[model samples]
Target: MALLDKLTSGSSTPPDTSGMSKQAKLVCELVADFNSNNLLTQIRNNNRSKSDIDKTYKYPDHFTSELIETKNFKMELLKWKNSHNPYVVLQFHGGGYVGAFKTQYRMFAGLYSELGKGASVLSIDYRVAPENPYPAALNDALYAYDWLLNHGYSENHIILAGDSAGGGLAMALCHYLTDRDRILPAGIVAMSPWTDLTASGSSYTENFEIDPLFGNTNESLIYNSVYPGNHDLTDPYISPLFGDFTGFPPMLIQVGSNEMLLSDSILVAEKAKSQGVKVRLSIYENMFHVFQMGMTLMPESKKAWVEVSKFLEQMMVL
Candidate 1:
């Protein structure tokens, strides 16, 4: 309770991280001093053009990316040579449904190469909200999946992955496929997913100031508002936590204990397990939202991806 109060009140006193590794403790301290909410606000107001945003970053050299443009949408294929398996990951990069970063896609490609047995990733530049809300992203994700299927990838050879909002999108896509009786992917990997658009999770309030990325529930809610349009916030399409997962594929969800979205991942994992879905949930101690963003730099990030790879391998064996 003292640690909770210390964090919630923004006290300079550090929390009792006795059990955390030195690196994890350092990360916690660094994030505690950061003003992530202010950064989020600035990004929301920047209004930068796509080209301008694209100019800020580039894909990493570990993988090669090829642009595939369509009449309605564009996608990129992140390929690594000498892959160990035949798996295709359809990635939905997270940006609160308003924007995405090229750097994140490159990191995803790195994840695929390291933990996924050199699996190729198809990163979709799905439509975002406010400008393109609700069904637009859903439609684009479905189209990308169909493209994969039509291009010779069997349903069993494919896996779905996403971070934050994209994680929710991946799950929604699975829900859509199940409802319509389509074949499901082999498995799904969600990293710090925002499963509840209604912002009903307890961590929203309890972990507000403690969460280094989101900072508070309202910040997440602002992003949520632009996407739902007139749709019900609790609609299973928007909040997959409310949906039934009777026949869903095996899933692995990773979230940081200090994140405001912690409860979102917890509740969804419970829901999936109740409906007989194979679910693996990892809660990293002393970490923040989407801590995997640090990737190779953070030990927790490396461990998370290793778990993801193990999960993928297990699913493939089933």
Candidate 2:
């Protein structure tokens, strides 16, 4: 709590990188290395069965990871705790449609569940690209949303959220639902969303050097090919920056200043505001992509979690 307070309090100096300690840096680097080597290619291949893929990554304690087959596709769910009638927070894991799953985002689910206080956090593992492609993942998200609704969860008690690609999908799902006259969620949260499938954001170039995760242009190009092929990348459903924000539920967005996707979040916020949608955007200075993953270690990350929790609580009251 003290650490969170200190982080929330104003500080002039950039977070003391010197105090990061050798062990912490090594741990972060090791995680990054493991992700880059093993998981990156595995996700891109998209050849492994769902069970085989689940076996590859490590999940945190207390998370019940399981596969639930919906009507059209199979979706993986990561439940943080046992609950009856808990508010449902359905999260989509980020991988640019190629990388992460419930295991990689288990920590996020745990933090959200803890802060939400009696809420249930479920991270959805949708099909990836170069195989499943566009509309497949989007369809899976809609199916998951429908499943929640059919299982006795009310739309007013549900929150949709995700990071990176999953973040974009959350927005796209909302658009699709709204178009189909489905009930909107209570709220939405996106962490560093990649809103522009076209990769048209100026920050993509400006933040390239500072962003540790997506520094290489070729890697992004390769990823773009897998998901947005033959589709109009600028289509509102594909690039949410181009979507209609009218009549959507309240939204909270958090993005790191150093990420290549920074502009994507900014554009979405601006568009939402233009349409009079209630929106709150927090830009964390000097933080890397999805810095919230460092909540266990970094003060900034913990502060972000608290802010998101407060925002969701307020939305629930509306």
Candidate 3:
């Protein structure tokens, strides 16, 4: 059951720099600088001034940023393209559930659209912690999903996907939908999903030195704190690894062998399999969290996208 010792056994290849537009390279550098300077942390800590902060930052293309109001709360939605039977992909972005914008995932939205054959993707900008506590983000995601269904999209045509925290949300949404007696989506894809908000997975220690995105246990604890309130982190709807996998749809999980969340994905896959849910897991060696974002430059990223596309095609035929 422990898959952590199985290394990728592959060589490290640089991302494809030739195909990258000058603007993209510039954006990557800027983001790298911002991350290095810990500006992202500053933004999250100062959530009270988000409006001014949002106005100062520039987002990438392929995502039209805007806000949507639901009965419970207001959240943002990132629209990729307009298409009939659009094969909608509801995306949740990763920022430890505290920071990160929809535009930061432009590469994913573009690749999903291209690989999914014109799928119109919408990345959810749910409420974050300290300001919005447990179930706030979950409620917003469910509301958006319901909006999509009401607007003519069938559950069978939708694909739930996300990276890091968003990946966890995808799994949580699946569990939530099933609980509501609603039809599940066509499929689900989680890239290094942070399934255990309690940070209780073994990889949190085993892969600590190997993971570059999250360096150590201390950092993981800080990220987990974003979720305010006394809710149980192990609640199946909160930490999907604890959720019932029975009656769930097919799933695809991709994670880096070096990520702290590696065990989280592995455990989810194991639980799904035990519950009779079809699951496919791809573990990329020497890769970091959400490494697929480098698809514009990384061969492995492209290959991962191809695998996801194949899974979606198979789900469509069912």
Candidate 4:
């Protein structure tokens, strides 16, 4: 209750961290060390060369990722061996539009498959920013969706999912499809989606200290500078917080109550609900930025996926 008060108070300060779980506390400490060591700065500085980052985050042997290359872009399909699942999940990995490493994306796909029992996830490695920039990633997402459709999956059988920038990208893709009269997916699941590139949300300042991953406004500034080029931040295709969700399918938006992007999820749900869209917003108590990444250890993270599975199951049947 205190956490909710802090979130809705619109105060640009963080709440007490005394109630955080042991795992969450450890993650907060680890991320603090990570930031103090300037690891994120190094990653952003490395640009398109992921060799160093790749070495740091490799997928386990159990996960299978098949490489798919197109003339224009590339993606990976992650699932169990000989999976016959008819449903598919097209996932966009989050790295502030600057990072889309396979390790993180593959892990997410693996978790989805495990949770859904048989569904497979296609993680799209779209062109990143400060190099390919906007529309490049968006176009690649659309292309990957088309590739899935061409491979025999129907629009209703597919689900769009992502975190952070990728979550924003997923929303943008829905808008793009809706605008072009293309068939939409059955549902969407976004984890801590950065819907507003402008960083206008009150949570940006309110939950700053509690959010372990995002330290300050500089991270957003760096991502915004490289991503948008000369485009306005308010453009719905870029910052989906302003997009039209009138024709959008049912969406499940999850965010940590302690993260700065909390407002992004709240407002997006409000906006979608206003348009008569089915939107379910889950705000986890005491969780931080993309805390679901702690699925291997955190109980809250595991609970989050359970909720996701329930949502997917309910939506896919409709």
Best by lDDT: 4
Candidate 3 lDDT for residue 297: 45
Give one digit per residue, the lDDT tens place, for model 1 in 133-158.
89888999999999999987889989
Most TM-score-accurate candidate: 4
List the candidate 2 regions with Cα displacement exceeding 4 Å.
1-67, 71-73, 76-86, 221-223
- Once model 2 is optimally superposed onto the true structure by TM-score, how far is the C-alpha of residue 40 displaced, in angstroms? 8.7
Candidate 3: Cα lDDT at 52? 29
Q: Identify the superior model by TM-score, candidate 2 or candidate 3.
A: 2
Model 1 score (lDDT): 0.76
Query: Candidates sorted by lDDT, descending order?
Result: 4, 1, 2, 3
CA lDDT of 110 in candidate 3?
54
Instruction: Kindly provide the TM-score of model 4 when superposed on the true structure, using C-alpha atoms.
Output: 0.86
**Positional deviation of residue 184's Cα in model 3 after best superposition, in angstroms:** 1.2
lDDT of each: 0.76, 0.72, 0.69, 0.78
TM-score, cand. 2 vs. native = 0.81
Cα error, candidate 4, residue 208 (Å): 2.8
Tell me the tens digit of each residue's lDDT in model 3 across 26-137: 5445544554456674664565324321333333443454655556544444454353435777777776666545444655665565556556676666777767877877
**lDDT, model 1, position 7:** 21
lDDT per residue, candidate 2, 127-146, as tens digits?
76766788778888888888
Q: What digit string (tens of lDDT, one per residue) describes model 4 on residues 157-231?
A: 999999988899999999999999999999999999989988888887898766666756455442345788889
Clashing pairs in 1: none
- C-alpha lDDT of candidate 3 relative to the true structure: 0.69
Model 3: residues with Cα > 4 Å off, grouped in runs:
1-83, 221-223
Each prediction's RMSD over C-alphas, in Å, is 7.7, 4.8, 7.6, 7.3
Weakest ten-residue segment in model 4 by summed lDDT: 1-10
Give the Cα error of residue 32 in candidate 4, in Å.
Answer: 2.0
